[model samples]
Target: MKRKATAVWKGAGKTGKGTLSTQSGVLKDSNYGFSSRFEDGEGTNPEELVGAAHAGCFSMKLAFVLQENDFEAEEINTESQVILEDGAIKEVFLITKVKVAGLENDKFTEMVNDAKDNCPISKLLDAKINLEAELL
Candidate 1:
């Protein structure tokens, strides 16, 4: 399956404004500009979107990994931090909190590591990946 999003930009780099649209329409003609990406602004940016996608994908992968190990999680919250350095993405840090019943620490850690290494998004990223998992 393939998903697509389109971005349209006009004018010069610093002064140009852009709109990003996704196939699902969640970002239909959403605003993105230099201020939005480089400075604090109300518009959306690519790094923010990447963080959201990474977090969502990691959470889902963690859930599946837990279930596969016979340890169903009650809640899984993941936060992905993408760091950009020298105009390129440098690292992706995943901080996850999981609430599961009847799962030991060692086993849970193993599963979390497996999910971090095997998740599709994680595999796709060339940046360094860091994960922190906790059971609550």
Candidate 2:
């Protein structure tokens, strides 16, 4: 139940660059720097990675919740927006588009909210998290 990623940085703050590598080898020595994080640059950033993780976690949780309720999801798409302000993560906005058969809108909304609240990543974040779910 443990995962790890390593970051190696060189030089000083503003111009310093780093490489991020994960245990899974999906991101082996991926580069990141100040411009990539704060401005438009050609590399991956921490916030983008966080957003991807959040989206993946929320979607999987929603799928599990539906299955536990005797339902199955046809498809689930999620987008997470990570907002940083004053050098701190302020909020995360989760937008979901779901497709399920034989499920009421109210029930879907309820499950979406439950997933948002119960997802491990969501629970770990100490910031405002909002969900906008669309049932299709």
Candidate 3:
């Protein structure tokens, strides 16, 4: 299966404005500008969108991993942090809290690692990835 998204920009960098649309229509011509990306603005940016994708992908991966291990989690909350350095995305840090029962620390860590390694977004990203998982 293939997924697609489109970004249209007008004007030069640092002063340009753009809109991003996804095939799913979750974001249709959403606003993205220099201020939105570099400064404070009331609109979405690429990093934020990437964070959303990473979070969702990791959660799904964790769910499947847990199921395969005969464990079930009440919820998996993940926060994906994207770092922009030298005009490029440098790293992605994932902080996750897993609400699970009947699992030991070692097993939980193993499952988390599996998810981190198997998530589609994590696999696609070239940046360094970090993960923190907790059971509660």
What digit string (tens of lDDT, one per residue) describes model 3 on residues 20-110? 9999998899999989988898789989988999999999999999999998889999999999889888899999999988999998999
Q: Candidate 2 vs candidate 3: which has greater TM-score?
A: 2
Shift of residue 129 alpha carbon in model 2, Å: 0.5
TM-score, predicted candidate 2 vs. hidden true structure:
0.98
lDDT of each: 0.91, 0.96, 0.92
Query: For model 1, what is the error of residue 89's alpha carbon versus the real structure, in angstroms, after optimal superposition?
Result: 0.4
TM-score of each: 0.95, 0.98, 0.95
Off by over 4 Å in 3: none
How many Å off is the CA of 124 in candidate 3? 1.0
The regions of model 2 sitting more than 4 angstroms off are: none
Residue 104, model 3, lDDT? 95
Sorted by lDDT (best first), the order is 2, 3, 1
Winner by lDDT: 2
lDDT of 1 by residue, 79-125 (tens): 99989889998899999999999999999899989999988988888
